[model samples]
Target chain A: MTYCVGVSLDAGLVLTSDSRTNAGIDNVSTYSKMYQCETTPDRFLVILSAGNLATTQAVIQQVKRDVHEGKPRNINNMAYLADVADYLGEILVNLIRKHNEQGGFIADATLVLGGQIKGREPNLYMIYPQGNYITSSSETPYLQIGESKYGKPVLDRFITRDASLEDAAICSLISMDSTMKSNASVGPPIEVLIYKRDQFTTPKHYKFDAEDPYLLAIRQEWAHHLNQAFRSMPRLEESQAQPNSYLRAL
Target chain B: MTYCVGVSLDAGLVLTSDSRTNAGIDNVSTYSKMYQCETTPDRFLVILSAGNLATTQAVIQQVKRDVHEGKPRNINNMAYLADVADYLGEILVNLIRKHNEQGGFIADATLVLGGQIKGREPNLYMIYPQGNYITSSSETPYLQIGESKYGKPVLDRFITRDASLEDAAICSLISMDSTMKSNASVGPPIEVLIYKRDQFTTPKHYKFDAEDPYLLAIRQEWAHHLNQAFRSMPRLEESQAQPNSYLRAL
Candidate 1:
């Protein structure tokens, strides 16, 4: 299982992914799942992937090969970010079909394609295993895949298109930390990238290992605040605490 | 889908559940999933259920009928909480088999049983549809059923066998709140019951509707504290934010 999130904010885009991969509990390993595509100076793109590792690696290799061979329809040649998502979705769909047709194993993967393309607005899209895709809307400025639920409450509470780039980056980590706490299938080293819209340059990337002090600090702080907040919840109204009420209900 | 949790602490036990049930989105309805059994004053028992609504309701009805008819193996006749868990598990497995043998649907419902049987310690057990049961330990003092992941991180952070009854109740509500925020399948009016050790009395019961002022206040307070906590995270070191780093990473 995997957990990845892509946030599209007015300031830029924040993308994050967990690195733990397991075939079985005994066969766990670490692999970087974040890849920044080398697009022309006018466009910027990064992909965060989750699902079958073989399928994802194949998709990434095919992407590199297309660019190396200068395939006419490569991501580097796409004029819009949505076009890039479409191209990636095609690669994913074909790979899945090819593997399924072989009948020995299942092949499926989901990817988040997010970035800015020239004069267009920065955006985010989650390409599904079926080759369809969905972009973040004004109502919900983020997208997630894989083991997503544990990390979602925080994102639902804080993420928005109006959020600043730094705030989005921080919120993504909190989301990741919450996930790592709840699910062993998802773990560190956590990789994060912050892409500033329109610049089309290299985004800031930070890799935090399991023992990273910054990650620990933020986790402890959040726990402290949560406990304090829990303590402050309006006390269960005294009237609601009546004893022996069970007898009456029965 | 449903979301229900039970917490056992040195101070007592806390059980909370959401009331929303649905066969489909268009058919959504509210139905209480919490049941407090009629037992002798020396004992107290509560069950929180999730999964196939029909199966759960049937199990509830069976327990009710057994007690009303003075069946030899009814809950009121059990001497140990573990024995009660075993009894409940048998009923669940037999009910499921009886339904599935007819061959039209999957008969499944998982339950969290928590309370005290006089002279025994307070306890919590999650009875599986397959007739197996698991109990909370000192290390992790809570059990959850249904849409559980979104609500687990909070319990993992705050619950312990030594926690106070009030703290456990507050923490359970927070878990319910988080689950409701991330998944539409789970909703309110939320129901919570707090059982103090040895009292064998009616534990307090509170139900909060969608617009309950207390629920609204806690949700708002939690959001405000979370945002503040996000802001206070250690800043991303400027040295890590180098430009054109993408070119080298490729």
Candidate 2:
């Protein structure tokens, strides 16, 4: 299992991914799910991937190989980031179809493609297994794939495109922390890459191992504050009734 | 789509459910998912249900009919709450199979059954559609059904066996609020039932409609605190590097 989230803030874009992949409880492995795709000064692109490891790896390899071989439609020369997303989706769906046809196995994967092209604003797109993709909306400026539910409430409450890059990065870690606490299949060495809206050089990337200081501090801080917050949450105004007995259903 | 959670604290049990049911986005309806089995001063059982509404209603109707007709294995006669959970699971699986054999549609549902019998300690069990059930453990003393993931993080953070009944009820509401925020399908009126330990009479039930004042109060309070908590969370100490330049992946 995997948990990857990409948030597009007005200041920048932040993408986060967990490293744990498991076929079953006993068959767990760690692999980086974040890839920098053909970055240069004017244009920068990064991909956060989830789902079948083989399919995602294959898609990444194809992208790199396409760039190396100077394919006509490689990420290097795409006019817009969405076109790169569409290219990635096509490669992914074709590979999935090949695997399904050959072995009757499902080889599905999803990707988050985001970055800036020289003239366009920084944007994010979530590619589906069906060779289609969607960008984040202004209201919900974050896109999540794989193990999303555990962390969605955090993003729903905190993520806004107008927020700062630092705030988005911190919130993504908190979201990852919440997901890791509730699910064993998604574990650490978390990776976060932040891209400033227009400075299209190598994006800021931070990798947090299981015992990273910032990770541990925020985890403890979040948990402690959550407990305190729960205490401060509103209490019910019990109606006048007999004490020490269960009040009848009303 | 539904969200129902049952928390078994040392103080007793608290069960909560939303009243929204939908076949699709266009065919949504309101229906209560909480049901009370035949209860006496000595025994109490409440069920929070999820899944196919028809199947759940059938299971509830069968339980009522069996108790009404004086069945040997009815809730009123069961010595242990686990026995009642098992009985409910049996009726559910049988009805599902009958429906499948007749029309070939999947009639699956899940239930959280919690309360106490005179001779047994207070217990909670989650009955699956396959006719098997599992109870809460000492470490994780809550079971949830239908659209459970959005609400699990709060339960994971705050629910413990030693929690006060008031704490448990408030935490459950926060969990529900999180779910409703993320999912339009899981809406109000929210129903909550609190069962104090060793008190087997009708449990204290509170219903919060969309505009309920206390509900509005906690929702606003929680959102405000969450924003405050995020600001207080740790910030990264970025290394000395070129200003406005993306940091390289490390």
Candidate 3:
């Protein structure tokens, strides 16, 4: 399992992903799930992937190969970010289908594609394995894939279109931290990228290993503050008495 | 979908569940998922259920019917909490099997059984639909069923065997609140029960509707505190410059 989040804010976009992959418990390994593609200086794209490791890696290889070989409709030559997303989706679906047909295997992959083209606004899109995609909206400016629920409450509570890039990045980190704490499959080192709108370049990227000082500090501080928050909330008033009958017959 | 949690603490047990049931998006209904039974003063139990509504309701009906008919091995006749868990698990598996065999349909359910029998200490068990069960431990003092991940981080961070019953109850509420916020399928009204050890009677029970004042207040206060907590955390230092290459070729 994996956990990756992409946030589209008024100021920019933020993407974060965990780096753990496992075919099974005994075969676990650490592999970067975030891929950066800059077809041109003005078009920068980051892809966060989850699900079947082989399928994702194959799709990534195909995309890079297409761009390098200057295919007719490659990521490098796409006119719009949405076109790039569509192209990636097509590549993913074809790869999975080919593998399934050849070996009767069921391989699937899901991706979060987010970044900016020279003339377009920064956008975030979740590409399904079935060769379709959905972009984030103003009301819900974030998209998550793989082991998402554990990290989702924080995003539901805190993410907003107007949030500053730095704030969004921090929120993404916290979300990833929550997921890591709850799931053993989602371990560190964690990768975070903050893309400034219209910059059309690689965003500021930070990677934190499990014992990284800053990461540890964030975890400790968040835990402390959370407990304090809970303790400070008003307690339920003690009921005057136990109800005469606690069971209502069905 | 549903979200129910039971916490075992030194003070006693805290169980909380949401009351939303849905066959599909348009077929949602409100149904109480918490059931209490006190066959005798010495043996009291509360069952929190999740999964196929028909299956859970049928299992509950069967248990009640057996007790009413004075079955040789009904809940009333069980001597240990584990025995009761076993009985409930058997009923669940048998009911599911019978329905599947008769109609070629698959219906499943999971339950959390927590309470006390006169001679034994308070206990908590999660009975799977397959007739297997697992209990909480000192290190992990809580068991959750259905839509569990969204609400699990808080429990992992705060719950402990020594937490007071009130604190455990509060934690369970927060856990439920988190689940409700993240998932549309899990909603209110919320039901909470706090059971004190050594007292076989029904625990203090409170139900909070979506519009309930206290529930609203807790939501507001928790949101406020969470924001404050986030703001108080130390911010990551700004990196001096964008790296020449942010991507390392895989």
Q: Pick by DockQ: which candidate is best?
A: 3
TM-score of model 3's chain A, to 2 decimals?
A: 0.96
Real interface contacts reproduced by model 1, as a fraction: 0.57
User: How does model 1 score by TM-score?
Assistant: 0.95
Q: Write the per-residue lDDT of candidate 3 for residues A1-250, one digit (tens) a residue.
A: 9999999999999889999999988999999889887568878899999999999988888888887898887887777889988988998999899999998997999999998878788899999999899999999999999999999999998899999887887788889999999999998989888888887755788888999888888888888999889898778897622364565476
Docking class for model 2 is acceptable
Q: A1-250 in candidate 1: lDDT tens per residue?
A: 8999999888889999999998988999998889888767888888889999999989988888898999989987787889989999999999999999897677789999988888799989999999999999988999999999999999999898898888888888999999999899999988889888877776888888888887788788888877777777677777765354652242
In model 1, state the lDDT of residue B62: 86
**Model 3 lDDT tens row, B6-75:** 9998888988999999998999999989989757788879999999999999888988899898889888
- Which candidate tops lDDT? 3
Q: Which scores greater on DockQ, model 1 or model 2?
A: 1
Kindly report which residue stretches of model 2 are placed more than 4 angstroms away from their true locations once superposed: A240-250, B240-250
RMSD of 1: 2.0
Better of 1 and 3 by TM-score: 3
The best-first sequence of candidates by DockQ reads 3, 1, 2
Supply candidate 3's per-residue lDDT for A165.
Answer: 82
List each candidate's DockQ score: 0.56, 0.48, 0.59
True contacts kept of 2: 0.50
The Cα local distance difference test for each model comes to: 0.87, 0.87, 0.88
